[model samples]
Target: MGQIQLQNIRVYAHHGCLKEETSIGSDYRVDLKVDAQLAKAAKSDDLADTVDYVHLNHIVKEEMATPSKLLEHVGQRIIQRIFKELSIVERVEVRVAKINPPIGGDVEAVAVVLSSSLPNFGNQ
Candidate 1:
């Protein structure tokens, strides 16, 4: 198996339980990692044979663009989209972080990680 990681995907979006947060929005960081069979792509040297980072980045941006109450929800949506769009992906891990959040203290960020593996993944 091989891994493709897209890290530090920065974006501004509305995602919070507070009304002000949803209205004003906040800065976010997204990271994604996917596992897939890479032997074919390694030998073929063809884009079609590999997991596309552009597509994964697009998914993270698209999902993060939509407003959600929690980072976990956003993370799950990203994972779901990846698995749906990329059939070859055997597993996925997504991290969604809210930067300089509204919490009433000095905090750099808060994040949630969500991951899943395809059922019967070991059968291969």
Candidate 2:
């Protein structure tokens, strides 16, 4: 087993609860971690044997393009997509952050983190 991480993916998206936030949009950063069996890839050195980072980034970008009302919702969607699309992934962790959120205070960002594990379908 091994871990793969995609960190600090910057995206410009319109996602927030406020109307102004959705109209104006903001920068977002996404961090994702995946736990999977990497022994086959390590031995064979083949791309097919492991999860592709580029594909993961594409998925995140696609999800971010759609507007959502909350960071938690966005993060959950990302986690679900990773599990649904990536068959090799056993567990996934996703962090979604909105840069310079309008909270009426000096706040740099607001973030939501979500983690999920795939069920053992083989055993079932």
Candidate 3:
């Protein structure tokens, strides 16, 4: 198995429990890590033999565009979509971070991490 990681994907999104937070929006960051069989692609030099990172990135961007109440929800959607769309992805880990969150204190960001494996994510 091999891993592919996409880090620090920046986006502006409306995702928060507060009405003001959702309407005003904030800068967000998304990270994705996936495990797959890459030996075939490495040897054959064919994109079809491995996970397409471009597709994975698209998943993140699309998911981020949709407003959710919590980061966990956003992360979950990213993990689910990757598994559903990529047959070769054996595992996935996603992190959704809201920069300078409105927590009434000096905080850099708040993030939620969610992960899943093929067996654990069977049919959903």
Candidate 4:
């Protein structure tokens, strides 16, 4: 088992419990860790042998473009999408952050991290 990571993926999205946030939107960052078997890809050096990061990025963008109320929901949606679309992926870790949260305080960011592991089914 090996990992492929997409880090610091920045996007502007509408996601919050507050009405203003949902309407106006804000900057968000996402980090994704995908666990998959890399032996075939490594041996064959074929793009089709593993998950395509470009395609995943597009999927993430599509999901992020739609407004949501919670980071947890957004993160889960990403995880589910990866798991459903990429059979090679056995586990997913999604971290989403709101940069400069609207809370009236001095804080760097607020974020939610979620992870889900799927059955390998002897593929690895």
Best by the TM-score measure? 3
Minimal lDDT window, size 10, model 1: 115-124
Better of 1 and 2 by TM-score: 1
Estimate TM-scores for all models: 0.95, 0.94, 0.96, 0.93
**For residue 116, what is the lDDT in candidate 4?**
85
TM-score of candidate 2 versus the correct structure, residues matched by position: 0.94
Arrange candidates by lDDT, descending. Answer: 3, 1, 2, 4
The ten-residue window of minimal lDDT in model 2 covers 115-124
Residue pairs clashing, model 4: none
Candidate 1 stretches with Cα past 4 Å from truth are: 120-124
- Residue-level lDDT of model 1, residues 20-124, one tens digit each, is 999999899988899999999999999999999999999999998899999998998888888889999999988899999998999999999888898843342
Of candidate 3, the 10-residue stretch with the lowest lDDT total is: 115-124
Report RMSD for candidate 1. Answer: 3.0
Q: What's every prediction's RMSD, in angstroms? A: 3.0, 2.8, 1.2, 3.5
Ranking by TM-score: 3, 1, 2, 4
- Residue 6's lDDT within candidate 3 is 97
Cα lDDT computed for each candidate against the true fold? 0.91, 0.90, 0.92, 0.88
lDDT of 2: 0.90
| Residue lDDT tens for model 3, 1-124 | 8999999999999999999988999999998899998999999999999998899989999999999998998898888889889999999989899999998999999989888999988655
